[model samples]
Target: MGLHVFGHDPSGDTALSERALIEAVDVLIFCAPIRQTPAVISHYVAQAAGIEREQLWLDITSIKAVPVAVMLTSQAEVVGLHPMSAAPKAATLRGRSMVVCEARLDKWRPWLEDFLAATEADCVRADAEQHDRIMALVQGMVHATHMAQGAVLRELAPAVGDLDGIRPFSSVGYELDVAVTRRILASNPAIYQDIQFENPHVAPMLERLAAHLDTLRDLVRQGDDEARDRMRETLLEQSRAYVGEQAIAEGSYAFERLGYLLADLHEPRYISVFLPVDRPGSLRALLSVFEQRGINLDSIHSSRSADGDLLFRIGVSRDGDTLALRSAMSAIEAEGIGRVVDAPG
Candidate 1:
C-alpha cells in the first residue's frame, strides 16, 4: 500500500516513454485490453531485453495462452494472471478464484501469490493452455449462449423499448438472465469479440453447442415423451455438474430477492431531476414538495455537468402514490425547477 506508483500514459501530459518506465520498475504489469495486449507486451518486452534478470513481467489478460506464450519470450520472469471477475468489488474479489499460469520461472510467484492473498483472493495455479481451455467454456461459450438467446428474443418477440413490458410474466431465472445479459451487452464489444476470436478452443465449443441445440430441437419435434424426459434429465444432470450444489441451494434466496424487486417495481417510481447549480435551496424546496405529500425518498445520486449544472437523480417509492408523484413532477416542471425524467423499471 505504501509503494510509490508511477503511471505512463502515451497520450497524457506526464507520459513516460516505455523504455523509461521499464527501466524504473522492478515489476512490469501489462493491464492492456485483450486485443492490444500482445503488441503492448511485445513492445515493452523488446525494450526490457538485457535490462535485468530480477525484473518480473506479468499480464492480466483474460485469454492466457497467447499472452503467456509472448511473455515467455522475455528475458524477465513471466507470470500470466487472470482475475475471474469483472470490475471486482470487495465481495467479488474476496475469496474469489484468480488463475495464475506459470510460464517461465518461480521467482515472482511468491510475491504475486502474497499480493493476491493480501486481497483475499484464492490463487489457482494453472498452465496457460489449461486456462485458455477452461475459459473457452467459462467465457466464450457463456457469452455466445447469451448472445444467441438475445438474438432469438429480438427475432421472435416485439421490440423491447421498455424492459418493464416483459417483467409481469418473468421468472426469477429470467430476471437474472436479463441482468447478466444487460451487463455483458453494456461492456465493450471488442473485448467479447477478442475472447471469441482469440481463443482457439471456442470454435469447437460453439460447434458442440450448435450440435446440442440441434439435438434438443429434434427431440422437441419428435414429441416422444420418453426421449424428451431423458433429454430433460440429462440437461439437469449436466447443469448440476457444471454449477454444483451451492448454486442450487442459493437459488431460493435469489428468488426471494427477485420477489422483493418485483414488488418495488410495482410501487411508484422515482423522478430524476437535473437542476442548475446556481439555484440555491432548489433541492430543499423539491424535498419539501415530497414531504408535504407524505412521500418518502428512496435513494439519491448527485453529479455536476461540465457547465456546472447540478444533476440530482432522486428515487421515491410509494405503494399507491403514482398520481401524486406525477402531479408533483408536473408542478416542479412548470416552476422551471428542473427537468424530470422517469426512472426505468
Candidate 2:
C-alpha cells in the first residue's frame, strides 16, 4: 500500500532510459484514448520488451476482446478490467458493477482478487468474447435506442412542443424516457461514439433493433384487428415467452419502483442536505431533526452534486409546513449534523 506510483507518458521520452524505467515497474496499466489502446499495450508490454513473468499488465477500457488478446501476447500476467459505470463522485466502486477478464493470470491472481475485493464492487467474471457480446446489448443497444429517441424528440419539438413546454402534459413513461435521452445527449459524444462503432457486435444488435421497430411501424400503419393481433403475437407474446416469467416480474417491479421515485423527485417541495462526516449514523442523526419537528417526508434519496459532494435529498409532502421544515433544517446545521444545500429543480 505504501508503494509509490509513477505515471509515464509512453510517447514522450524520459531523461533516463525509457525501457529501463518501464522494466522497473511491477505493473503497467493502459489508460490511453480508446482507438490507440491496443497499439500502446502491444508495443510496451511485449515479451521481447524485457517485461518479466511476474509483472502485471492491466487495461481499464470498455471493449475487452481485442485489448486482452493483445495483452496476452506479453509474457506478463494479463488482466482486463471494466468498471461498468461512469467515474463516480465517491472514490470506490462500491455497489456498482465491474467486469473482470482474467486472460493469463497466474502469479498475480491473488493480489488482483484482493485489490478488486477492497473496491467493494460487484464483480462479474467473463471471458473477453462474452464480455464484448453482452456489453453490446447492455450498453450499445440501450444507448442507440435512447439516442434515436432524442433525435425523434428534436425533430418533433417544432411541431409538437419543446421539452419544457411538453413537460406539463407528460405521462410517467414519457418523462422517464426523456430523462434518459437527455442524460445521454448531455454527456460527451466520444464515449457513445466508441460504444456504437468500436465493438463489432453492436452493428448487428442495431440491425435487430431496427428490424423490430420497422415491423411495429408496419403493423401500426395497417390499422386493423388483424394488425393488432399480429402486433400482440410478435411483440408481446414472443417477447414475454422468451424473456421467461421471473425476469419479467423483476423488470416490471423495477419499473414501478422507478416510477415512484420519479414522482417524488418531481414534487415541488424538497430539501437537499450534505452530511460532512463519513461514518455510521450520520444520516439517521440528520433525519431525527425532521422527526422531532413532526414534518412528513415523501421520499429521500442520495446523489452527488456537480461539485462532488454527497447530498441526501429529501422530498417533502405538500402538507408539510414550510416554516417548520425550515426550522428543522436550521437546527440540523446548528447541531453540526449536516449542511443544507439548495434543492435541485
Candidate 3:
C-alpha cells in the first residue's frame, strides 16, 4: 500500500485550507510557494496551538531566513531545509547538497538527521541568517548573471539562433551557462522571482555583481596595458586570493572533470543503452558485454530517459573498433540485460 501524504502543493500560490495537515502528522512541512509560505505556516501555527503534541516544522525553500523566522512563531521544533539542486529525476539525492538550519531544534534534531539520511543527500548545517547571506551570492548573483546572459542571447536571436540554434558554436563555458539558464527558465518563474526579490541580501548582492560587470565593460573599452593590469588585479588575482587556495584548487579540479565529461559527450561515436531490470548486477552485466567485445569506453554516464528509465550513455574512443561496439550492443539485448536506445549510424 502507498503511504498517505498530507502536504500542500509547492506550485500553488494559496495556503493550506485543511486542518488535517496540521492535526494528522507529527511533522507539518509547508511545501507551498515562497510568496505564500508565511501564510501557509501561519495557517498551520494558528491551528497548531490547540494541539498538545510537540511536533516538528520544516520547509524546503531556497531562501531560509524568512521561513525559519516564521516557523519559529510556532510552539513546535523548527528547522529549514534547502536542497541546493534542481528537482531530482532519480530516487536519491546522493550527489546533491541539502542545507539544514537548526532554528528551534531540541528533540527534532535526531528526527531531522534520520530524514536527511534516508534521502542520501550531502547534508550541511548552518544558522538561518548565515544560510540566507550565502544564498545571496550563490543563488541571487549567479541566477541574475545567467538571466542577463539569456536576455542578451534572446536579443541576438534574430542574427544568431536562440539557445538551441546557438549550441553549434558554444564554448564549454557558454554551453554550461546555456544549460543552467535553460533549467532556470523551464522551472516556475515565481521561484526565481522570489529568490531575487524576497531575500534581503540579494538586492545589495546584485549591486556588487553589477559594479563588477560595469568595471569589466569600462576596462574592455579602455583596452590599454593599465586596463589589462587592473582587470587581472581586481577580477583574477585579488578575487582568487580572497577565495583561498583550497577552494581555488577544488574548483579548478571540478572544472577539469566537467571539461573531460563534456569532451566525451561531444564525441560522435557513442551509444545510449537502458537496462530494464532495476536490480544489482544489471550494470555489471551490461558493462561485461563491452568488456568481452574488447570495446574500450571513452566515457560512461547515466541519466534518466523520457519514460524514467535508467539510461546509460557510453562514449567509444575515436580509434576504437566500431564492429566491436555494434557487437556489444547486440550482446546486451540478446542477453536480456538492456536495449540500445541510440547508437552511431
Candidate 4:
C-alpha cells in the first residue's frame, strides 16, 4: 500500500511537486476543498511532465461535471467520486455512499469494488451532468431557501442571538425549522457558493423559483375571490404537470398534517418584529394605521415579550401601489413599531 499526504502548500508539509507525485504513482487520489479542484488539478498536471495516460486518476469533488470533463481529457484514466457524508472524527465509513461517474466498469470493476468493500461503502453510479443538476435543487436551492428564512427570522428578533429552544413555536413546524437552521449554520460558505455558482443548470432552476414566487406575490395583492381561486387552480395545474394528479393530491394531504390550512388569500408575508409596546392598545394603534390606509387584515398573530411588549405578525392584503403602502406604513408616529422588509435579492 502506497500513500502520501498533500496538505496546503504553505503549511510546511513536505511533499513532492505535482509533477513528481503524478509521475511516481500508479493510483492517484486527489482530495481538496470543492472550490480548489481546478487549481489543484492544474498544479498536479503541470508537474507531471512525462506521465502517461495509463495511470488510474480519481477526484473526490462535490460537483462532478467540471471535474469529470477536466479529468477525462487528461492522459490518465479518471473516476469521479463524491462521498455523501463528511465526518472528521469517524473511524470507518460504515454506511456512506460513494457517487461514481464516468467509471470504466469493464476495465476496473474488481479493483473499484474491492476498494469500496474495504471502506464499507456502496458504489453508486450516476451521470456527471445529471448528478450536478439534481444537486442544484437538492443542495443549492434548499440551502438558499433556508438561509433566507433564517435571515427573515433574525430581522424580526434582533435580540435573540440563538434559537436552541424557542417557545410558543408549533411542535412539528418548529422541529423542522430547527433542523433547517442547524444544517445551513454548520456548513462552509465557500462550499455553498460553489454549489450555487459552478453548475450551469442552477441558473434556470433559480430563475423558475423566482418566477413562481413572483406569481404568488402578485396573486396575493389582487385579493379578488375569483382571482385567488384562479391562482389556486393554476398552481395545482402546474404541480400536476410535474408530478401526476395523484401525487399532487397526496402532497396536499401531507401538508395538512402540519396544521397548514392552505387557503388562497392575498396576504403579505410576515416576519416577527420585536418592538416596545406599552399595552395591548399599542398593537391595535398600529393596526388602525394600516386599516385607515385600506389594508384589510388577513391575519394578526402575536408573541409576548418580558417587558410587556408584543411581537405582532400583522398580515394584511397587498393592495394599492407597493411604494404607497410602504410610505403609508412609515408615516406611523410610533417609533420602531414595524417595517416592510425586502425579500432576498
What TM-score does candidate 2 get on C-alpha atoms? 0.92
lDDT value for candidate 2? 0.85
In candidate 2, stretches whose alpha carbon ends up further than 4 angstroms from where it belongs are 1-3, 9-21, 46-48, 343-345
Which ranges of candidate 1 are over 4 A from the true structure?
10-14, 89-92, 159-162, 237-345
Note the clash tally of each candidate.
Answer: 0, 0, 0, 4
lDDT of 3 at 255: 83
State the TM-score for model 1. Answer: 0.70
**Native-referenced Cα lDDT, model 3:** 0.85
User: Model 1 over residues 148-213: C-alpha lDDT tens digits?
Assistant: 877777775577644567777787678777777877888899888999998899999999999888
Per-residue lDDT tens digits for candidate 3, residues 260-298, read 888888899999998887788888998899889788888
lDDT (Cα) of model 1: 0.78
Candidate 4 local Cα displacement, residue 108, angstroms: 3.2
Candidate 3 residue pairs in clash (backbone atoms < 3 Å): none
lDDT agreement with native, every candidate: 0.78, 0.85, 0.85, 0.66
Taking the tens digit of each residue's C-alpha lDDT, what string does model 4 give over 1-345? 135544435246457655666666676777777767866776666656437466777888888887877666567777888887764233446667778886543456567667767777667789988889887887778877777778877776456544533544346566566577777778787877887788787788889888877888888898899768878787766667889878877876786653342232123453344445445567766776666777665666654444434455555455544554564456553455554332111
The alpha-carbon lDDT assigned to residue 300 of candidate 4 equals 63
Question: Candidate 1's error at 307, in angstroms?
Answer: 21
TM-score of structure candidate 3:
0.90
Ten residues in a row with the worst lDDT in model 3? 1-10
Ranking by lDDT: 2, 3, 1, 4
Enumerate residue pairs that collide in model 2: none
Q: In model 1, state the lDDT of residue 308.
A: 48
